[model samples]
Target: MHLVTGGAGFIGSHLVDALVESGQKVRVLDNFSSGREEFLSHHEDSGRVEIFRADLLDMNAVKKSMQGVEMVHHLAANPDIRLGTEVTDTDLKQGTLATYNVLEAMRMEGVSRISFSSSSAIYGEAEQMPTPETYGPVMPISLYGASKLGSEALITAWAGTFGAEAWIHRFANIV
Candidate 1:
């Protein structure tokens, strides 16, 4: 079984579709802050998809959702960068703290593998057009970017300390 956080959003919902097509059972944990249920409505009858409407900030809810999960696809984050500026802690709470909860819950549940949806914003104001993977001196210009970098750090730390498997994919703006 696969667990996808923010699985009702555009990208996450599409991922759930692909997973279901591959004959895998998926558990979707989403808060609906930005995720729309209609995106995942197609899967209602399959029984291969289970939707858990909960926030990642809730440790108990996160833990409960992690039950019997094999792999985790963590895509939940504050999608609005401008909103982060208005609410200073938006990114910190939604991105960093939420990621921490997921990792901690995973630790307790003994779920090792996690695939994180990171962003190219982490390489803020890069000198090059397409920043290299080894780009240095990452100085994020936005709170959203900083939160992503922080979440990535946390994931790496969890992997190193607990022997967990992690895949951090830094996605660029789509078209």
Candidate 2:
């Protein structure tokens, strides 16, 4: 089974739809903080999609949800940059800690592959207008960016140590 965390949000909901259309069994783990239930309502009748209302910050809940899952698409996060500043721990809890829980869960479950939705914010104030992947010293000015970078590091370590494969995607502002 394929697990899509934050599968009720905009990007995640669309990803779930595409996965469902491809005849894959999908499970969703979402807290609904930024995600809406209405987004997955259409798939309620499909039987191919299973929904679990849970926060990624809860490691036990994330571990429970990972049972029998072969792959994970981790999308759950505090997407608002402004909120990260006001709520100091928002990015840490949602981005870094949540990612740690997911990786640990995957390790315990023996799941081997993971796809993460990271951001270009990790590049921070780039000396180059359009920073290339080979750019040096990625200094992130925002809490959100730092959190993403932390998650990426954890994922890389998990992949190397636990024999898992990870695809870390650094996305630019598409929306």
Candidate 3:
């Protein structure tokens, strides 16, 4: 079975659709803070998808949801950079701590692979227009970016020590 952390959000909901179509068993963990119930409502009747309405901050809940899952797709995060200024700890709790919970849960469950949704914000005010993965010394300008970078570091360490694998994708604004 596959686990999608933010499986009720825009990107996550779409990913669920594709996974279901491909005949894969999917389980989702979301707090509905930014995600919507309607996104998964259509699949409610389907037995292939299981929904767990919980926050990533809850370690026990996260661990419970990760049970029997093989691969994980972690997308739960506060994407709004503006909110970071007002709620200083929001980025840390949602982005960093939440990711930590997921990683720990996966480790305990003996799951191996993970695909993380990083961001171009980690690069901050880079001189390079089209930044590549090999970009030097990532300097994040906002708390959100810092949280993502922190999560990346944690994942890297986990992969090296636990013999796990991950694919980190840093997305740039298309428009």
lDDT of 1 by residue, 32-95 (tens): 9999999999898999999999999999999999999999999999999899989999999999
lDDT value, candidate 3, whole model: 0.92
By lDDT: ranked, best first: 1, 2, 3
* Error of model 1, residue 80, in angstroms: 0.2
Q: CA lDDT of 59 in candidate 1?
A: 99
**Candidate 1 — which residues are off by over 4 angstroms?**
none
- lDDT tens digits, residue span 1-175, model 3: 9999999998899999999999999999999998999999999889999999999999999999988998999989996888999999999999999999999999999998999988899999998878888997899999999999999999999899999999888877523
The most accurate candidate by lDDT is: 1
Worst 10 residues of 3 by lDDT: 166-175
lDDT of all predictions, in order shown?
0.96, 0.93, 0.92
Tens-digit per-residue lDDT, 123-169, candidate 2: 99999977888886999999999999999999999999988999998
Better of 1 and 2 by lDDT: 1
Q: Specify the poorest-scoring 10-residue window by lDDT in model 1.
A: 166-175
Model 2 misplacement above 4 A: none
Quote the lDDT for 108 in model 1.
Answer: 99
